[model samples]
Target: MLDPILLWSGLVNGLLQGAIYALVALGLTLIYGVLHIINFAHGSLLMLAMYGVFLLFSQFGIDPYAALPIMVVGMFVLGYGLQRGLISRASHGRDENILLVTLGISIVIENLALFFFQGDTRTIDVPYAFDSLEVFGVFIAIPRLIAFAAALLIAGLLWLMIQRSDVGRAIRAVAKEKQGARLVGINVEHIYAVSYGVGIACLGAAACLLMPTYLVYPTVGHAFVLIAFTVVVLGGMGSFPGALLGGLLIGLCESFGGLFLGESFGQIGIFLVFIVVLLFRPSGLLGSRV
Candidate 1:
C-alpha cells in the first residue's frame, strides 16, 4: 500500500501545478471566448514570456517575482499590437485564417527564440529555490506555495475584471454579438485586441510563477501545449470556471499517475482523462453546450 504521507504530498504538489496550468488556460479560453480564435500561438507566447523572465533575471539581476508586473505589461502590449496590427488584418475575420496566422506566429516565435537564446535549456538560481515548507509531514516547495497562491489570486482578479469592469462589459458584448456591440458604440475590434492582450497577460503572470522552479528553452512551449489544450477542452472551450476545475483534476491525475505508474507511464492518466472527457462530456464540466 502507498504511504499516506507520500500520497498527500503528491496531491498537494499536483494541486499547485494544476493552478499554474489553469492560469495558462485562462488566457487561451478568454481568447477563444472573445475572438473565436484557437490561438495556436498561445504556448509560444508563454515560452516567449518565460524567456523574457530569464533575460530580465540573468542580465539585470531582477527577481522573477519582482518581474511579474514588467512581464505582464510587456506581454499585454505585445498581444495588443499583434492582434491590432497583424492578426486582425491578416485573418480577414476568418477563423481558419486566424488559425493559420497564429500557427505562423508560433513558428516565428520558436525560431526567434532559437536564434536569440539558442536551444539549450535555461534555469534560474534563486536563493529560495531549494526551500520548502512542511505541513503534517508533507513538504511543499516555497515557490510552489507562492505559485499556488498567486495563481488563485490572479484567477479571482480576472473573474472580477470580467464581471465588474466597463471594458470587460464591452468585451462580453463583443463576445456575444460583435455587430450588436458595435451598434452600442463599443469598439468591437478594440475589444478583440484588449481581450487578446488580457489573455496574453495571463501568460506573463504564469511565466513569473513558473520560472523559480521550471526550466526554459526555445521549444519549452511544447511541454505545455498539449496539457493546456486538454485543460481547455476538459473544462469547456470558453469556460473560465471549467478551466480552473479541469486544471486541478488534471494535476491530481498527473501526480497520482506519476506516483503509481512511474515517470515513463505517468502521463497516461492525463491522456485517459482527455479521451474520456471528449467521449462523454465534450462540453466540459462547467461549460454550456454551444
Candidate 2:
C-alpha cells in the first residue's frame, strides 16, 4: 500500500536536505559574489569541519552539536587566514590562478582524509538523530528540522550583517565597485577576507548541524558540493537570496522527482532543472551586474 503519509514525509525530508544544501550554497555564492572565484576548496573545508567535529567527540567526549561554536570559530579563522595570506596576495589579475590553487588544496584535503580515516565511513550517533516532531499531521525529523531552522536563522543573520553592519556594508561596497570602495577608504583586501571568512564559517556550521544525521566520509563533501554549486548558478552567482530559493526549489524537485521518477533520479532531476534555468535565465532570478 502506498501511504499518502509517507509521500508527504518524503517531501519534508527532501526540504530538510535542501535546507542544508542551501546553507552551504549561500556561502559559496557569497564568496563568488565578492571574490569572483569558484572556490573549489570550499567543499574540502566542509569535510575538514566534519572531521573536526568527529575528532572532538571521539577525543573529548563532547557532543558534535555542542561543539558547533568551536567549529565555526576555527573555520572562520582558517578562511580569513587563507584569504589574507594566500588568496589576497595572489589575486592580482589572476582569478584563474586562485581557482586552480584552491582545487589543488581540495585534492590535498581529500587525500589527507583518505590517509587518516582510511576510507571508512563514520557518523555521530546522537539520541535525536532520527527523532521527529509532528506538524500539521506530518512527522518531521528533528535533525532536519533543526538544520532547516538554522538555515533560516543563518540566512537572516547574513542579510542583517550585509544590510546593517559597517563591515557588511564594506563587503557590499567592495563587491559593487572595488575602486570606488577604495576611493572611500574602504580596505578592499580586508573586506574580501571578511566575506571569505563568513562564507567558510557557514560551511563549517553546516557540517556541525548535519553531523547528527549524516555520515562522516572523506568524500561526503563531494556529494553536496555539486548540488551547492548548481544552486549557486541557478540562484545567480552574486545573489544570496537566490541561493536560498534555488536550494529550496531544488529540494522540492528532488523530492517530487524521486516520488514520481525514482530515488536514483532525484539528483539527476536537480541538474536537469539547472539546465533549464540556465537556458532561460543566465543572469539568474535576482542577479544584477555590479
Candidate 3:
C-alpha cells in the first residue's frame, strides 16, 4: 500500500506545478484557436520573460512579483510586433511555412540568449523561496502556492474576458470564421496581433511566477514548450478550461508516477496518458468536433 502522507504531498505538489503548466498551455491554446498557428517560440518568449525578471531583480532590486506588470507590458508589445511584422506575412503561406517560421524564431531567441547570457543557470533569491505551509498534514511550498493562486485568477479573468467582452467576441468570431469576421468589419490582422500578444502576456506572468522556484537558462524553454504542447493537445486544442484540466492531470501523473516508478518514468506516464487520450478522445476532453 502507498504511504498516505507521501500520496498527499505528491497530490499537493502536483496541483501547484500543474497550475503553472495550465497558464502556459492556455496561452498556446488561445493562439492556436484564433490564428491556427502553433507558436513554437512560445517557450522562448517565456525564457525572455524569465530573463527580464532576473534583470529587473538584479539591477534595480525589484521583486519578481512587483516586476510582473512591467514584464507583461513588455512581452505584450513584443508579441504584438512580432505577429504584425513577421508572423502575419508567413501565416498567409502554408502550415509548413508557419511551423518553420516559429521554429526559426525559437532558434533565434535561444541563440541570442546563448550569445549574451551564455549557458549559465540563474535563479532569483526571494523571501518565500524555501518557505512552506502545512495544510492537513501536507506541506506546500509558498512560492508554488502563490503561483497556483495567480494561475487560477488569471485563468478566470481570461475566461471572463473571452465570454463577456467585445474584443473577446471579435476574437471568438475570428477563430470561428476568419472570412466571416472580416466581412463583419473586424480588422482581422489587428485581432490576430492582439491574440498573440495575450498569449505572450500569459507567458510573462508564468515566467515571474516560476522564477523563484526554477532556474533561467538559454535552453530552459525547450523543456517547457514541449510540456505546453502536450498540455494543449491533451486539453483539447482550443478549449480554455480543458487546458487547466489537462495541466492538473499531467501534474498529478508526473508527481505520483515519479514517486512510485522513478523520476525518468514520470514522463513516460505523461506520454502514456497522452496516447490514451489521443486514442479515446482525439478532440480532447472538452474540445468540440467541427
Candidate 4:
C-alpha cells in the first residue's frame, strides 16, 4: 500500500501536471472540434510561442508574462494565415490531407528553430521559480500550482465560450455542417481561420504559462506533444471538458507512476491508458461520434 504522505504529494503533483496537459491539449482539441483538423503542428506552435516569449524577455528585458497578450495575438494571426493559405485548401473530412499539411508545418517550424537556436535548451527563470508551499507535510511546487490554476481557469472559460457564447454556437454549427453553416449566414471560411487562430493562441498561452518551469528550445514542443494528444484523444476530440479531465487523469497517473514505476515508465503507463481508452471508450470521455 502507498504511504499516506506520498499519496498526498502525488495527488497535488498530478493535479499540477494535469493542468499543464489540459492547456496544451485545449488548442489541439479546439481545432479538432471546430475545423476537423488534427493540428499536429500544435506542439511546434507551442515551441514557437515559448521562443517568442524568450526573445522578447531576453532581448528587450520584458517579463515573460507581460509578452503573453502579444504572443496570443500574434499566434492567432499566424494560425489564421496558415490555415487560410494552407489548411483551408484541405477542406472538410480530408483527414489525411490535413494531417499531412499540419505535420509538414510542424517539421518546418522545428527545423527553423533548430537552424536558429542550435538545439540549446533554455527556460524562463521567473522570480520565485522554485517557490512552493507546504501542506500536510508535503512540498508543492509553486510554479506548477500556478500553472495548474491558470490551466483550470482557462479551461473553464473555454467551456463557457463553447457552451454559452454566440461564437461558440457558430463554431459548433460549422463543425456539424459547413455547407449548412454557410447557408445560415455564417462565413465558414472566416470561422475556420479564426478557430485555427484561436487554437494557436491557446498554444501561445500555454507557452507563456509554462515558461517559469520548463525549458525553451527548438524541439521542446516534441517532448510534450504526445501527452497533449493523449489528453485530447482520451478526453474526447473537440471536447474541452474531456480535455480537462483527461489532463488531470494523465497528470495523476504520471505522478503516481513515477513514484512507483519511475518517470520513464510513468509516461509509458500513460500511453497504455490511452491505448485502453481508444480500445474501449473510442470517443473518449466526452467526444461524439462523427
TM-score of each: 0.98, 0.94, 0.97, 0.94
Q: Candidate 2 lDDT, tens digit per residue, 144-234?
A: 7888998889988998998899998899889879999999999888888888999999987898898888888898898889889988988
* Candidate 4: Cα lDDT at 266: 78
Candidate 1 deviant stretches above 4 angstroms: none
Error of 4 at 213 (Å): 1.0
Model 4 lDDT, full chain set: 0.86
Q: Global lDDT for candidate 2?
A: 0.86
Q: Give the alpha carbon lDDT tens digit for every residue of 205-280 in model 3.
A: 9998999889999989888888889999998998999999998888888888898888888888888898999899
Number of colliding residue pairs in model 4:
1
Error of 2 at 183 (Å): 2.2
Best by TM-score: 1
Q: What is the lDDT of residue 278 in candidate 1?
A: 80
Off by over 4 Å in 2: 1-3, 91-93
What would the per-residue lDDT of candidate 1 be over residues 165-279, giving only the tens digit for each residue? 9998898888889888888899888999999999999999999999999999998988787788889989998898999998888898898889989978989989898888888
State the lDDT of candidate 4 residue by residue for 62-167, as single tens digits.
7867787888899999999999888768645477888898999999999999999999998666787899899999998787777778778877887888789888
Using lDDT as the measure, the top candidate is 1
Show how many residue pairs clash in every candidate, following the order shown.
0, 0, 0, 1
Q: Please report how far candidate 3 places residue 123 from its true position, in Å.
A: 0.8
Worst 10 residues of 2 by lDDT: 281-290
Scored by CA lDDT, what does every candidate get?
0.93, 0.86, 0.91, 0.86
